[model samples]
Target: MIGNYLEFNVFFDIIGTIAFAISGAILGCKKKMDILGVIVLGLVTALGGGFVRDLVLGINPPNMFQNSTNAIISTVFSVLVFMFFYFRKNFTSRQVLIFMNEFMILSDTIGLASFTITGMTTALSLGLDKKFLLIFVGSITGVGGGMIRDVLAGTIPFIFKEQIYAGACILGSIVFLLTRNFLGDQVSMIICFFTVLIFRLLAVKKNWNLPRISD
Candidate 1:
């Protein structure tokens, strides 16, 4: 039952949201933005995707507004991340910077994977069993927040750069829908999450990218 997976769903969403929120905060810091600007970017990166997803689905009053838990999670993590980066200059060394970069990548991958599965399953519940819509929504939900953050930060979104990030989402979504009927929703979601996560990690390691046209 959906209720049985409630904790499971919330746990992943929280982890994903926190991850993305920190990514946004880190970007904001890099952009030399103030604390408030970092907070805004972080929250936007955390919830923008779900807002767009719910809005497109015509679900009035998106869950981001209705659910205070995600908002609190986003705000708390965003602020904490910003503060950590802001204060680490004097005491922290080069290793800390390397760790921060690695942590950001790790969290971003988790966010991408978790959101892809969450969005796909949510669409399925709404009776959108179509292949294209499920994949579209799933991919959008995974990357939408990051897109918003990047645009607001005056940079190109990651997906626009020919990275394999969204591609991983699309593939995972398709796999999730295909397996859901036979494997059950929870099982499908778990598989889909790992699919995207592993795929992106592999792509990053291999330096994979879409073929870019001229210079």
Candidate 2:
């Protein structure tokens, strides 16, 4: 059961990585960044979460270096996506926005859920006891890539201002922690993913936001 759960998690991680890489490439293209910049954004978005996770875990130099497959996959996928957009530069803003809205929603949801679960799993393996630490790690893993991507692209990080962005990650981590023992690990993961995704989409549809205080 554990082995199957691990395998599924790894598969979701790869898919999430590719999706985020595509998102980064799309954003780079929108900003009229050079090809090198586009590739950089893609690489950062794809690997940034895992890189941070490894660093926090003290896995010196990181698994991104140890695992050549991940690096190659991220690079190849990014380049292909950039090329696709590069050839379609004539697309209107409305068309672009439509595409971006759909793409970002899908990619961000997957990335958020996968990273949250992975972060929680890592924290548990590392013997972290605090529930809040699970939430923090999960939120960081989910948003770290977009933070890096936005910084590199000279834009505000979406999660800091966007509607209920990191909320999904927080919810996902909570679900994972709460249900890990009651359900099988794989079942728990699936439930967490769907819970986060559904909540995120609903938040968007409803334009949900936390209360703000005026300074």
Give the best candidate by lDDT.
1
lDDT by residue (tens digit), candidate 1, 159-215: 988458899999999888788788887888889999999999898888899988877
TM-score of 1: 0.92
Task: For residue 105, give model 2's deviation from the true position in Å.
Answer: 2.7
Instruction: Enumerate clash totals for all models, in the order shown.
Output: 0, 0
Point to the candidate with the largest TM-score: 1
Residue 141 alpha-carbon offset, candidate 2, angstroms: 0.9
lDDT of 2 by residue, 169-212 (tens): 88887887788789877888888888888888888889897776
Model 1 error, position 56 (Å): 1.5
Model 2, residue 183: distance off in Å is 0.4
In angstroms, give how far residue 105 of model 1 lies from its true place: 1.8
Give each model a TM-score.
0.92, 0.90
